[model samples]
Target: AQSVTQLDSHVSVSEGTPVLLRCNYSSSYSPSLFWYVQHPNKGLQLLLKYTSAATLVKGINGFEAEFKKSETSFHLTKPSAHMSDAAEYFCVVSLLTGTASKLTFGTGTRLQVTL
Candidate 1:
């Protein structure tokens, strides 16, 4: 089984400053890591994903995350924050079981931006 742990439930950032959202995962095999964003009353959107292709993966909205096998961590970071970026973020772990992959979502982190 694969699982994800989001360290923080809420993260507040000032507009234009860097942002960080920590996450960790547990999996018996190499799992695919993904970051998803959900705006108010909106559907979830894939921000970025790491599928054993690269250690450092870049995503939309200047967001990026580095997959560290040794640490079992995939923390999302952005160079700067925007008010529009405020939303709920989910760290997901996907594992191939049989023919289809199953996704496990973390607790979710809500990002709040203040001007």
Candidate 2:
């Protein structure tokens, strides 16, 4: 079985400050991890993905995450927070069955950017 957990349900950051969103994951087989962001009434957008290629993965909008096998973590981070970044983020784990992949999503972390 595969599972993912968002360490924080809500993360509040000040504009122009650093942003960090913690996540942990577990899988029986080699897992593919992804971070997705969703703005208000907007469809989920693919931020970044780690598929055993690189430990550090960079995504759109200045977001990035590092895959740490030792700690079983894939935490997302950004150099500075932007008001437009306020949205819900999901940490996802994917397992390839045969031809398709099954995805498991965390409860989600809501990012709030304040001035």
Candidate 3:
């Protein structure tokens, strides 16, 4: 069985500071891991993905995650948080399940940016 776990439901940051969000996952095979950001009432945009390749993966909008096989964790990070980064971030796991490709998402983490 494949599964994913997101550690935080919400995060708050001041503008121009760094951002950090945590995630963990479990899978039978070397699964694909992704971090996606969604604007309000908008579709999910892929931020990054790990497909049994590099351990440290970079994504758009200055976001990056390190795939830790030993720890089974993929935590997203950025050097600075912009006001535009104030959105809901979702940790997603994509895997195959019996004739269907599916995505199991975390509850979601809302990032609040303050001045």
Candidate 4:
């Protein structure tokens, strides 16, 4: 068991619109938080990560996330949604439990972009 929850199973946004995806987490130790974007059959690309080095982390393609320890949340956002942005987004947490580093994933949030 690790910390991290994506509140929405799916979200829809029109092209050129803003996009928001929610995520919450719980961890016993400091965690390495990450938001990964997967495009159709492609491998996950790291959108951003928090490693206790920063509170607010910015990622590629106009995506960003803020780490709020008080709220136990790390939400991802984008200023505008592109037609190619339609894909599966995963909110994940990396933890070192025992001797291995593990990646725990939320159920996942699907982004539907429409023109």
- Measured against the true structure, the TM-scores of the candidates, in listed sequence, are 0.98, 0.98, 0.93, 0.93
lDDT of 1 at 84: 97
Per-residue accuracy of model 4 over 8-102 as CA lDDT, tens digit each:
99999999989999999988877889999999889999999999988989999899999998999999999999998899999999988699879
Q: Looking at model 1, which ten-residue stretch has the lowest summed lDDT?
A: 95-104
Better of 1 and 3 by TM-score: 1
Write candidate 2's Cα lDDT for 1-115 as tens digits. Answer: 8999999999999999999999999998778999999998999999999999989999999999999999999999999999999999999999898998888999999999999
Shift of residue 104 alpha carbon in model 2, Å? 0.6
**lDDT score, candidate 4, position 57:** 95
lDDT scores in order:
0.97, 0.96, 0.90, 0.91
Strongest candidate by lDDT: 1
Model 2 misplacement above 4 A = none
Across 30-115, the per-residue lDDT of candidate 3 in tens digits comes to: 87889999999999999998888889999999999999989999999999999999889998888887988688888888999899
TM-score of 1: 0.98
For every candidate in turn, the CA RMSD to the true structure comes to 0.6, 0.6, 1.3, 1.2
By lDDT, rank the candidates, best first. Answer: 1, 2, 4, 3
After the best TM-score superposition of candidate 2, give how far the Cα of residue 16 lies from its true spot, in angstroms: 0.5
